[model samples]
Target: MFYTLVKIIHLLCACVVIGYLIYDVFIFSHFKKNRSEVEFIKLKRELLKPSALILGLAFLLLLCSGAYLASFYLGGELGWLESSFQQILVLKISVVGLLFVFTPISFFYILVLKKSDPMRKFYHHLALLICLIALIFAKLMFLF
Candidate 1:
């Protein structure tokens, strides 16, 4: 029952996070470059906080539940690690680990760096790319 609940939450959060990540990468970033100031501010005001919160919760739930599921169901199985499924799972986990590292640095950069800093945009785009890749790899893990 506990596992089932965690799995549900994990899946739900993953959906929300992945959807937001796709929008961030393909929609929001493009708007950042091309949209008018008033339009961009409106979009940013409407989405920035909600997206961040959802993505943050998704990451948290994904990490906790995924680790629990792995440790609970596959802890003693060496062959699982040797399987193609496990190889994809390992890659997914690696992407998530990279996200864990990149997220904090991105947050710090946002908090500390001036908006005028040229690297801010680069960092923001890179972080979004990481999140997108992580989401894609995570889905791939379930297929194999």
Candidate 2:
């Protein structure tokens, strides 16, 4: 029961981060050019803090819960790390680790750099790609 609950929380956290990354990369970018500079700047300023909070918190929770769940699979008589499924989990965790590094850099660009810079969009797409890779590994972990 406790494991099930943690799995649910982990899944929910993944959904939150993935959904937000999708929104940031696809929907937000599409809408960005439609607005005038002044309006867009105002909107960006308003949305930045809250979006950061949501994404950061969700990603943190996801990593924490993932670590908790992964503990069930590590270092046993059968040697969990030697299995293909656990290997895929390690890959997923590694990819997520890259996201952990990139996220702060992206946030720094968005917050400290000029709002109109193109790097923000680049970072968003990069994050989306990373998340997709992790998602793929997740499926593979279950399959094999």
Candidate 3:
């Protein structure tokens, strides 16, 4: 029961982050770039702050649940480190860690750097790629 609950929570959190990343990467960021001053200001006032807060919370939940899930298989007979799945899992975690780091940096850039800055796109696309990779790793983990 506890494992199932945690797995569900973990999957939900991953879904939240992945959905938001895809939207931000392919849609929101581009829309933000092209929006007029009034539209951009409206976005900053209404959406940006709330989205950041949600993303931060989602990332936290994902991190904690993911860590808990990983802990179950890391030692004893499961020995995740010895399995073929270990490398991809580790890579996914590392990418998630990078996402965690980049989240704040992207926010800081949004706050400080001009909207015209292309760097945020770089970060967004990188995050999108990692999210896709993590999803694939997740599937492989279930199968193998």
Candidate 4:
């Protein structure tokens, strides 16, 4: 029961993170082209605060719950270093770690600095790619 609850939390948080990234990369980005720069900037400023808050919270929850979930697979006869599942999990965690770094940089570049660089878009795409890879590793964890 406890494991199931934690798993559910982890799943929900993953959905939140992926959903936010999709919105950020696909939908919100395209709005810039339709609106005037000033209007877009204003809209971005208004939306970024709440979006950032929710995303940050979801990430924190996801990380905590993921660590808990990973603990279950670590305590078998095979040492974590020797287990294929653990190896894949380590790779997933490493990829997810990149998002921890990327998220702050993306937020700072947009919210604090208030500069819209083309490179920022690249970072978003990269993050989305990273998340997809992590999701793939998640599935591979059970298969291996």
lDDT per residue, candidate 2, 1-144, as tens digits?
999999998999989988987876777666688998788778876877677887788888888889999888776665767999888888888887876676566667678973554555476687789988988998888888
Q: Is candidate 1 or candidate 3 better by lDDT?
A: 3
lDDT of 1 by residue, 16-124 (tens): 7667656766787688788898899898878787667767778788778889876653536565577776777777677666655655665666777734444544554
Tens digits of per-residue lDDT for model 3 on 36-73?
A: 97896687567557778878798788889999988876
Residue 19 displacement (Å), model 2: 0.7
Alpha carbon lDDT at 118, candidate 2:
51
Off by over 4 Å in 2: 48-51, 76-80, 103-118
For model 3 the TM-score comes to: 0.74
Per-residue lDDT over 55-117 for candidate 4, one digit per residue giving the tens place of the 0 to 100 score: 889889999999999888775675676778889998898898887786677678788889764
TM-score of each: 0.65, 0.80, 0.74, 0.80
Model 1 spans with C-alpha error above 4 angstroms: 33-42, 77-80, 103-119, 122-144
**Whole-structure CA lDDT of model 4:** 0.85
lDDT of 1 at 113: 71
Q: Rate the local accuracy (lDDT) of all candidates.
A: 0.70, 0.81, 0.77, 0.85
